[model samples]
Target chain A: MSLLSNSAVEKNMDLAPAPLKKEKVKMKKGLQLFLIALPFLILVFVFSYLPLYGWSYAFFNFRPGIPLSQSEFVGFQWFKSIISNPTQTAEVMRVMKNTLAISALGVITSVLPVTFAIFLTEIKASWYKRIVQVLTTLPNFISWVLVYSVAFAIFSTNNGLLNHVLTDLGIIDTGVNYLASDNHTWLSMCMWNVWKTLGWSAIMYLAAITNIDPELYEAAKVDGAGRFRRIWHITVPGLMSTYFVLLLLQIANFINNGMEQYYVFQNAINKDHIEVLDLYVYNIGMLGTNFSFATAISMLKSIVSVFLLFFANKMSKILRGESII
Target chain B: MAESILIKKKTKKEKENSRSTKGEIVFNFFNMAFFALITFICIFPFYYLFVNTISNNDLSSRGMVIFLPKGIHFTNYLQVLRLEGLGRAAIISLSRTLIGTILTVFGCALLGFIFTQKQMWGRKFWYRFVVITMYFNAGIIPWFIIMMNLKLTNNFLAYILPAVIQPFFVILVKTYIESIPAAIQESAELDGAGTMTVFFKIIMPLSKPILATITVFAAVNQWNSFIDTLFLMTDSKLYTLQFVLYRYMNQLSSLANIIRGSQGGSSISASIANMQTPTSVRMTVSMIIITPIILVYPIFQRFFVKGIIMGAVKG
Candidate 1:
């Protein structure tokens, strides 16, 4: 027993030096990886975080050519102008109304994609389903510029196809300016959005459907449930969690109706109802050249969006017992 | 008892055949028709544009070419392609897509792999630092200001550099790498492979699927982006095809004038010149811009679906 203990003690004494050496080698390797990772970190810092420093421009009357240090410090004066001044207040309110109205329409119509997905799975013919999916999803791949061009070709006053058909049918004496008309601009925009994203968003729900247990369908079938009942009880219940999660995300992004779509579609006539917050910022910043005021508005938007995201996260945690983030 | 059980089974079968089959048939017909209509709506615009651009411009401009081509000619595409600065813009767009995609894929793959290593210094903190950027943006003005301050205005690097470290792609790649069996990496380490060596030799090959996914994403984004060009490129040389198409759409008269100016030297007849209407020019330009997407998107589409599934599952 003493000999065996001595042998074990000797083995430990010999191996005690090895881990320290391995630690040194491991530390060196980590340093090498850190060196390699440093450039990407710097790139992220420059592009992502570095812009946060420019948010300070809101406090200054920043000019294009002049340095911020030389610009006058306004100290929330631009933010004050958004409320304290009547004309500015009206403009902000109008922009907010446009933004909120468009977003609300978006949220309300969000269920259509879910419905589309449910019905899409009901199609028995696989080839037809694939074709529908491929074609419907194609528009999402193209840029908004191309979509606008498509809109133009189909709706232009002089050479629109809709007008050509309508005139041939004697539906009207003249062509309606569908693209430029301010009437139902919100609804039309929503329709255009639905046309673009319905298939793409349905893909998420479809994926979620695949995750549902096939055994549930089997059990429901054994219980003599009808096809519609099975879909209602099994598939829909399975998809609600995904739907609610995506809906929460949509709500979190309530204010960020992206600029590209609205930017390309907006014109002099439709600008009143079509301009959302992001587009408004771009217009004032780039076209109006109100950099300081634009900065202030966008700063507020970013803060509100982040707060909304956290609020949604909290809601998700409280209700679903999961952290979305 | 056996006879009564047999009768009950027959009745249930009859009920299924008599009632459910008819209702399901009707439901299926409408469902198929509805989807067929949607498919047609989705496909018809591209067909309309193609027909218009290829048709005789006089008839097309008069709204005569609705469902089909009237006088087939490719002159609008020819003339639009011959426009000044278009060839350069195409080259610029192509180069940006290639280089930017490669850079982004490499950056994402490397960062993702390193982040999975337990030995990575401050791996959790660094990963969070990168991933958190996905949630909040500093807004457009500040971003534009920073780009200008960095001298990215009128510079091509403006497109390539800012896109390299997309936090969303990084997270996607990190999740994917985590799913790869760590035993393989450990085996590579046992073979005396260094970090860079192991990454190049083993991890990259194993990661082709996810990397392919990100490649499609990065390439599509690079090809479709025009807002960046609109903001940063005051220089005409750096304009992408999409942005140039946008310019033509907004300024149809000037575009028509330019086409006429370009075609004056050709011995074409007055009728041919008349065929190059502003509307035709715009439609042709739009077609040209979308052709690549139309051709490539279907081939790489499954990768995108895969990416969406990955994101959904991880979330």
Candidate 2:
């Protein structure tokens, strides 16, 4: 009878806290946690989600210093203007062409950092490697304004060192306005981007290389493979996943060639060629006072970018069975 | 016989490894020279700017100060230091960097810690809500309009507040904190420690490496950002050092006033006037803007490396 009573008490102890009291405690903890997180949620709402509401401005003739509600609502008029008007369409087409061209160039050259990483690892001296890495990564830290300053100091038409040296060497008779010239604008921009990002981008591949199993190299050596063979067989394949992931990300970000680089690099002469979608949006919105239209173009851009990101994630999952986000 | 053949093959491989082939030696020579040249290219521009700024103005403007300083003088730097509104802009930049970095690091750390709590309401939903923002950006116009609506335009808080809770940094901090053992927090909680107490007292003290990483990224971004000022601030009092330098770089008219003001007002020497050319002044100002970054970079660089690796793993 005592054993039976003890078993009954044990069952009561187990089952009693499983429903109401446990739920109350769980809810109390959740409430405390929610309170802790509420402020951050509010911040994210303001900065990120809030701007999304501003996408509504694309449909309105938004005037500065005027309340949005007081403004006249134009239903898809700005978006329709982009499609219906000839000159506007032509300008946008040009901007789109430039954007695709620049992004395509970057995609083609994305192999460079992988090559840089492989070669960088081949160097015997670690100190020399570290110094090269540090110095090459330096440009990534400085602002594009400073980069432009360096570009201007080196390539300015009048007092540029390029012209000065070229003329002195009889390579050219006078200074050429390289900065202002429209020739190879996209290529030059891509080259500048490569210069800025090569070392910085290589860091990821380097990290991947360290993650490669040392046993692979040992087995390759045991099999009488040479250094280049080892790199080709072991290291390159090991880094493939990392490279593909980065490439997928770049594809997702294809249109977001940020405005800053192109903005600082652009000049009156190269405006036709150098103006990308982001820069064009900035030019129209801020420089030309066409806020509604810029907002419209950007709304489309954001939609496309989100779509591309999901597409990329889909591809990542299909190919690698893993997702980036 | 098979074992002997394997031994022979191993020795041959060992020999090949000990002595690189002739082709590889040639390739290595070129590779080293090529990378060395690249290193030179990376550093030469700054060095050129430096030599030009310090050299005689006539020579630098004439493109004579190529490799080294021809006439060494601190007059250009002195003139730049005395430029109108320079000190005020420097102060604004410094304050923003300090305040922006601190707020962002703290916000990211705290939010990151909060998200890791299993009891947090709507944990998965909220995490996705924040992380999804990283993939798409509201275009500059919308962003600008929002800031305007928020009355952040031309306000100092515009710099500090928008950046306080960077989503990417939040993700980094969250990932780092997740890697830490959860048992420690459980123990502390058993002792009646609150969430904030666990975060501040236990989690934070253990997460210094990641905190440092976030600090470097935040500080550099704040110091280098000029687009916000370019779009939002019309007030010269709110101009940052980088923005001012940008104006001086792009608009010669804006720079002319400062150069003329410096040369015309003071009882300066003839040589000092010769040293304050437009190119010299521009280069000097660029130097001024970049010096702080270069100063702090070496110390914070390892943290960034760790940060990048962490990001790579998470990605």
Candidate 3:
């Protein structure tokens, strides 16, 4: 069982409690622990579950400060609109297409981290390796807003360095507006993600590399394997298992292409190519202020996500011999 | 360092087992060239921004300050520092990161301690209560409405209180707490110490690594956060440095306003007008925004690496 959850770890323990002798004392101790945990329980209920109660707004015609009883309860109307209304269904199709495309790119590049960890293992210079790893991983901590600044500083059409360089070299008389054009949105965003996360993603693979019994390398050396042969035979095989397990987890989260990066990069010109499902929900809810419609869309997304998670968990158990959750 | 040396010595032995081919030299050279290019790709943007931020506005604005800074000047930085409400925003960001990290860490650790008591009543049920939130949420609209109902919109408490009940951190702390010898807490109880006393006097001291790690995580999250402020802090007075930097980057009018508001007498306003645009100033402000995170990064990096590894590093 993973330590990421207490309930899972507790469930892993099969020991049965001693009964009968000190029942009253055990009850008192239980009450004490329960008292201490009450505040946390209440906090979770208020912040986490309370919004769950507000999900009822998807059924009712919710307005600010109005009682649900007073509002019109339209059962499954919004949910039905998801499939019935032509424009809404088309919008959903577009967002789903974008989400699946972006997520596919992300899953495909997940292999690159394993490539990175292997390359890192081969580097002979400790200082240089450390420098490269440090520089690459540092971007992971930076916020998207700050990242957008860096992107803008180098890529912005007006007074941008890239434009200046291309124009000066006579490659083009007029500057190309890369950011404003929707032509290469998917590829550009994927590359940006790879740049930002390359080192960060490789970290778990590095950890797995450290766990590779060094004796395997010694054994391979005894068998006359060269560097390339050893990396191919031993390191790749070991790392691929971890990568596939992680990929299974990603498959479960297929729809959750986070909205922040797209939100920052989005504009009138690029929004058509970049808007994914999560961003669509956010825009419709937060920007457009259609609370009920947005909630219905998200409720559907969440339900699908839960089912996907369950299927992935079952697949992981079959493949890896355990469930993640 | 040791790993590299060990692997290198192994390579030497392995080479003796099989003759080294002449083609290997060319392959190694190309491999080295490939890595160098990648390293350039990773670090060049930030370095270019640094150079541009320091170069003279005339040179930078025309995009002539590419490879290095020329006619270095601090005028842009000075103007950014003098921007209206920059000082106040810095204060808000600093206090929120500090207090928010402290409260969230202690609160999570405390709740974590309780859950680890093994004998706790309905422990599994209560644990799931927190854990289940990780899987499901009420979506953004309902959350925003709830935040409004709590009357926390524009309140500083909105930032601190919402983060204080992090179930993920609670689970992390609980995992560490469970590893501590039950004998220590048992003996403390034998000596008639209460739960709080045992937690503070015994468990807290022993859990330093986890506490420090959680603190760094929470502090960085708080410092980097502008989403909460964006949704809730409509009041200009509550803006943090992140929010300010975000505005300066996104909106051209906001950049113009920063210069006009920081008017610093007629001479500064005259210089600002003469400058034509604040593109370099935007770069300077963004540089200022990110400098603190980059500076303290190395100190907290080890903890972050450990956290990432434990969290499975799924990007």
Best by DockQ: 1
Docking class of 1: medium
Please tell me which model should have the higher DockQ, number 1 or number 2. 1
Q: Per-prediction TM-score of chain B?
A: 0.94, 0.91, 0.86
- Clash count, one per candidate: 0, 0, 0
**Model 3: residues >4 Å from true position, as ranges?**
A1-26, A63-70, B1-29, B264-276, B313-315
Ranking by TM-score: 1, 2, 3
Q: Could you give candidate 2's per-residue lDDT for residues A73-102 as a string of tens digits?
A: 999999998889999999999999999999
* Chain A TM-score of each candidate structure, as shown: 0.93, 0.91, 0.89
> What ranges in model 2 sit over 4 Å off?
A1-26, A65-67, B1-21, B267-273
What candidate 1 gets wrong by more than 4 Å, as runs, is A1-17, B1-9, B267-274
- Tens digits of per-residue lDDT, candidate 3, B1-315, equal 999999999999678545565455666666666767877887788788888877777777877888988877666676676778788898999999999998899889998999998779888888888887876776666777788889889999988988887877887788888888676676567557888899899999999888888888898899888778877889989999888877877778877877776763635443432252568766876787778878988787788887766556322
Ranking by lDDT: 1, 2, 3
Top candidate when judged by lDDT against the true structure: 1
Error of 1 at A195 (Å): 1.0
Measured against the true two-chain complex, the DockQ scores of the candidates, in the order shown, are 0.54, 0.49, 0.39
Best by the TM-score measure: 1
